[model samples]
Target: MTNDDSKVGDIPGKRSLRPLGGVLAAMAVSLTGTRISVVALPWFVLVTTGSATQTGLVAFCEMAPYVVVKAFTGPLVDRIGPRAVSWTTDLASATAAAAVPLLHALDLLSLPLLLVLVALIGAARGPGDLAKEVIVPEAAERGRVPLERAMGLSGVIERLASTIGLAIGGSLVALLGPLTALAVNAGCFALGSVIIKLALPRSMGHTAEEASSPARKTEPGYWRQFGEGFTFLRGEPLLLTVIVMVGITNLLDAAITSVLVPVWARQSGNGATAIGLMGSVMGAAGVGGSLIAAVVAQRLRRRLVVLTGFLLAGAPRFLILSFDAPLGVVLAVFAVSGFGAGFVNPVLGAVFVERIPRPMLGRVNALGDSLSWAGIPLGGLIAGAAVTAVGLAPVLLACGIAYFLTTNLAGLRREWQEMERTGGQSVPEPSSKDDASRGNANLAT
Candidate 1:
């Protein structure tokens, strides 16, 4: 029952933010590109190929490999180091991304070729993104920030990136066309790669000493390492619950982002401007909520915060769209949803970090996140087909209802109670004088 203030970092000064800052900067840069590609890629497929199905197929091609590659990349990260994996993967992604526009400009790009390029991007991004997340706890420890606050700030950075990226992506697609936006995305990935490759000191993701240790040499093979992660996940009911719930929601979100929103903009004759506007608004509100959560949420009961956040963040946007509501009302609903969504991840990140040991972080986190995101690849596909089949309103309504049930009902499990039991870092040892001082203060007070 010690307060959060009882903890402090052993690192000198606790003044340097470089480790954490570098990680965040890389995350921001890369994520911004991914978000832009989200808008631009689909638009490119739709406008060029004139097929929503093709768009979904391309999305599926990208994300399926993303999940699979990231799942297996974890062991290598623990062994070879996340830093090298991160930059190299980003370089691959950049090359793949650049080829799309280059080939298209040459008028030599076929649909099959486009799909291959998109898949390559997904494969590379999978590892790169995981590497960055893997770096966070290490960076946080080095900087002496509370794990929860660091996660909150991470959420803020992600929200900020998503906001700015979507805004810029939408604008670029509208004003300059999808190819230009794609070009910018390639540049972002390249820059992010450079930052991680050279900007941060060598100690961030894994130590060279650790990498060379006999224990490292003796570590299990890839499948065995993966099995360890799988076993860890299978044993954690809370983590499983979160993964399943998030998986469903992520699927729905993918549907919205990849198909619903873009289709809505096109059908409404509002085009890319409206899509960008909605994403920007939601991201902005999410940033505000993440900031507030970082400041005050640590003291609150975890289950309540999680449940309340789900209630606010889920269902509304889908329901609003289903109603064919006025744009103003839809925007308002999205804003509220974004705010509620903000409280969720920081809390989730804290719980996840506390529950897992450092050694197993990469594999476990990769598996968990990949599973939670398992449905993402299919999201666009399902939404595209559904909207094409029964029309948009029905699909939106079904998704909204499903989202509402999943978020609210899923929180009822006894396993979720685990969130409250976990403590941050290891408990500190209290010295004799410290105990004596505390007793004296208690008596005097």
Candidate 2:
């Protein structure tokens, strides 16, 4: 649906959700499509190739370009504006996604060709996803919505999309097969592109576009813009610490979802059904937790909520599986982890939004998020090798221990003190003077 509100200022003492809802519509669909791909792609490789190493290799091909391209595309998003970047990239992703099954139908698909297409999809998706995130603050502002509430709502949307996507993915893969699921994924990407291009007001994302028009010809170049984002990220110890810690966790998480769990499903003879069930249970619980956090997390102590969430979310599933726990216990651990994981991103999002100003959101977000996600590409590959070399239990144990140290032990550092103090705040728009001073600081540093 189209957004009815698009002005810069919020109505006094009144909240509007139309703008945020409009943005979330496209975002939610695209995210769901990604989750579905997470299911369909791996299974496709596993069954067609019957090789876990190849599965991990395919994942690495997709994510390596995804991380690198996204890191560099942030400046482009700021220069061209999120809406344009989002729609264009989504369209590109749709085309790439559709090509896969089409080629396979003609018996033209080969491993190298498939990897090439997957890489293209990942490259397009990086800019697409970053653009979507850049729009959140603008959407929140235009609707006059509270930043924390809006961010929390975004977290809820992600969880719900993930939940439904996994459920649908499992059923589709089990019944209709991965090709059918791949076709549906193509449709989602196309639909998300249309929604963003047509449903949002022309006035949306005007800030970024205006900042980079021909009249501002002397404005900082792309590399300079990227450098500023990097410098700012370097200066913020708390943000750096958080990114490093989360990067480790993201790596572990990627290994689990992409390699470990899929292998576990196959080895146990539970197959896709078990994989679907475990993911769906965790995702469903995550939705409930995200909904609760959306309402009350902004009011709680940030440090406690975040650490508790990590503690609950991290390590348990790995440990549980390592012990060869019963089905019910495994599911229970997944559920608890999902619930705790729900509180994490909302708190992190709020802290992120509170710290960065409007002007810096595009570049800084690109840099910071890319850095945190840097290890993800390697996760699947490493896990596959480890599983092959040392066996599953040992690999799982090492990852669990590493996750514990990265998240829990690292939290004791002084940088995390900032999380407690800045839990529920929103940043004001940066003025011209503020922007100038920041620009000078970037140059000086």
Candidate 3:
């Protein structure tokens, strides 16, 4: 049945929120650890090397593998099931993350060694993250929640993770050094691994193929499955357009967070505490915005919410920082930006889950996510070199202008007109290839 005919509580039997809660809890701890690294790792590289280029290189090493590995793992996630993939990868990531601090304490942590460790963490995180995204829809189904509200809750959890992670990260780096912060990150990953393994229902996170045809003998090859996802994505103009726009924005965001922000912290004499304070304030405001969106967003126009969110979320922070504004002024701009950002992912995620069929969810979602995130590795590299060649203010100014132009121009495209078509409920699997091709969707970075 189409979403219009299906209500949130339509499932006849008793619905359980346990599946959704487990997924979100796992997401929260893991994401919090990653956020802590966002603060601690860049600061660690910059202080240790005393070079912005090297700091950018460190980011490059981590994200390059993250994007590549995630792109290839979509079919594997679909075949082997997301649950097994999620736990195993989280465990691997925890091991790699823990190794960094342990090796450093022995004075054996060379720059090359550190890069290897972070790269390992990124590689493992790629599929680990994809598994979580793949499971959300099924979990939401088990919980009998609307897709929009589920995605909104996901956004809220993510924002909360960022607030807590950044605040603790900045404090730890400022007070006890980056190593202690990194150790905490490792512990968080381990805990998240345990949660996922033990908390979820056994029937959750299985492949759609398995659920639909367990007695079937034949299955498609890995490359064939990957190609199916690619072909389906290519047919959807709206999704393609969204991916392109998000790719550009993700690049700018990566540059700002990985290189520009830390450089600005050093130049403004604000130090690590300022970095933590700025991030936490923005994240705290984001939590408020996401909570509102979780409650009321289904009734709003997705297109308007997205365009407005981008208008507020993008450009302002870069411009504010470029002017060397007072700390309070900078934070005010960040809070506004963060609030706007809080509305974006929930809508986009709803669009994605509604358009793609359940069976193809893993592969299509992976390809869309990987493409949108394609430029992240280069963002820091380009920003770092540009800043070194000219200065921090000019680079920030240039990036801010670029961010404003790219987002607004993309909004003018006709495909975005379809953004409001989502019916606030889940779509069932399409019976034919052409039916699937007719569906529209959006993506986020």
The residue-by-residue lDDT of candidate 1 on 285-364, one tens digit each, is 99999999887777778789989988888788888887777788888988998999999998898788766656677888
TM-score of each model, paired residue for residue: 0.85, 0.87, 0.85
Candidate 3 weakest ten by summed lDDT: 436-445
**What's the residue-level lDDT of 364 in candidate 1?**
84
> What local distance difference test score does each model get?
0.81, 0.80, 0.82
Model 2: lDDT of residue 393:
90
Candidate of highest lDDT: 3
CA RMSD (A), model 1: 7.9
Clashing pairs in 2: none
Least accurate 10 contiguous residues by lDDT in model 1: 425-434
lDDT-better candidate, 2 vs 3: 3
Error of 1 at 426 (Å): 9.2
In every candidate, how many clashes are there? 0, 0, 0
The true-versus-predicted C-alpha distance at residue 412 of model 2, in Å, is: 1.4
